[model samples]
Target: MWSGDELDLDAYLARIGRPGGSGAAGELRPDLRTLYAVHRAHTAAITFESLDVLLGRPVALDVKSIEDKLVHGRRGGYCYEQNSLLAAALERIGFEVSGRGARNRTRGDSLLAVTHAVLVVTVEGEPWLCDAGFGYQGPREPVPLGRPGAEVQQGEWTYRVRKEEDGILVLCLLRGGVWRDLYAFSPQRYHPVDYVLLNHYSSTHPGSSFIGRVVVHLPGDGVRRALVGRELTLLHPDGLAERRVVGPDELLAVLDREFALRLPERDAAELVRMYPAGD
Candidate 1:
């Protein structure tokens, strides 16, 4: 079992833009309000990005390395790194948190791998789903896990979780006047080692989406901003989208300005070469 003492809870919370973390008495406790505050701060502060993977660097999932990367380094990461860091922060804050894997079913059944990592937290004997790693399309707060269905509203988006057959839980996002399945998972407690295999595959595999393209996402006050390769899309709260093609020369500027990423010169050059806007 991982303990919260291993991480600097105060530093972690501050890095995620939640300087005032946890209970008022100063001792971190397992509570819904704290959970929501942490989740919201993380998603808004630290972006969900795959630049390292695309740049041919090894994506380490160890707690120390993850902390350094996201906190000290001020870099963003994919699901495995993002969720792992959050889980560690929560665990150290006295929350009974467990790692879980989920299969992204948004594309189709063709991609059936446990590539997503989420946290299942038990506070007061009740389970809550907390994920700050699912790009910009996840619940903005910790959602309660229950039977039938539960809808959670975060600003302009509505997320639904429903119990499915064979003890599977399906998470869906409401979009375009329809409910789209985001991912599905079983009620199994996973650990950091469980994500090692999937992280390697997702970061290094030629078929992995995170490898060939540059994906950067940040959720804001009333909109979600995403920069995929050469396309920049701003998604409004009402499910409306506006997109435009960004030139190769302006890509790094967009990354720095909009996504708040200060990439190294080498990585910036590599991205330009890989995703040139051939106008």
Candidate 2:
């Protein structure tokens, strides 16, 4: 179970720009409206990045470590940290939250390992797929799990969950009139320990996509952007993607401006030093 009691709920809420008080805290009830609001605010405020992994630092899954780095420190994180923090917040709000390990399906025809971490939140006895960590292509709000193959529109983006023949639920996105598979997850409940193991492989394994790379993504209503290595790609709802190369001199600025991320002076220098060597 997520350590909701251990999390500083107010701090987490404030970090996402939703201050927890009589005004806002009163609205943080365990319901669909609060779930959608929190999920949207989180994805809008915190970016998706693998800077710690690229810096060779251990990505801790604990609520404290994640709160320190992401909430207090004003830094971003990958799936585990993002969804873990979210799950903790929702759980603290008296919502039913669970974990699910998902396999990345956007890669190709080859099946990949179960590395992605997502959350399942139950509201009024109905489960909703609440993911704030799928990068630029992720959902901004909770996608209802009760209705499969139903189009759920979050702003201009369209997403749907299809039930495969094997009972697996695959999340798909509509891009340029095509339904592209984003990732697939099973109903098997994952725990914090499971994420710790998945985090190890993703942060250390040679085959990991995040290793030796500068990966950052920001999801938006009009445009979704991702910075992979030196190339920066902007994706639109119509499936039009524009790519451009980012020079080393502009790296930090791009992260700050585009992703709303600014590292410390020391970390900035180190990331700049390692930027040229990235893939």
Show model 1 residue runs off by greater than 4 Å. 20-25, 109-111
* Tens-digit per-residue lDDT, 16-45, candidate 2: 998766566656799998999999999999
lDDT of 1 by residue, 1-279 (tens): 554566767778778776544553266567877788888888888889998887788998888888888988888988898888888888876788998889888787676778888889888898888898888677777878863487787887878887888888888888767788988889888888888988989999887888777899887767788888778999876779999999887888998888888876777788788886674
RMSD of each: 2.2, 1.3
The TM-score measured for candidate 1 stands at: 0.92
Q: What are the TM-scores, per candidate, against the unseen true structure? A: 0.92, 0.97
lDDT of 2: 0.94
* Model 2 lDDT, residue 132, Cα: 93
Residue 185's C-alpha lDDT in candidate 2? 95
| Cα error of candidate 2 at position 79, Å | 0.3
> Which structure among the candidates has the greatest lDDT?
2
Could you tell me which residue pairs clash in candidate 2? Answer: none
Strongest candidate by TM-score:
2
Residue 8 alpha-carbon offset, candidate 2, angstroms: 1.0
Worst 10 residues of 2 by lDDT: 19-28
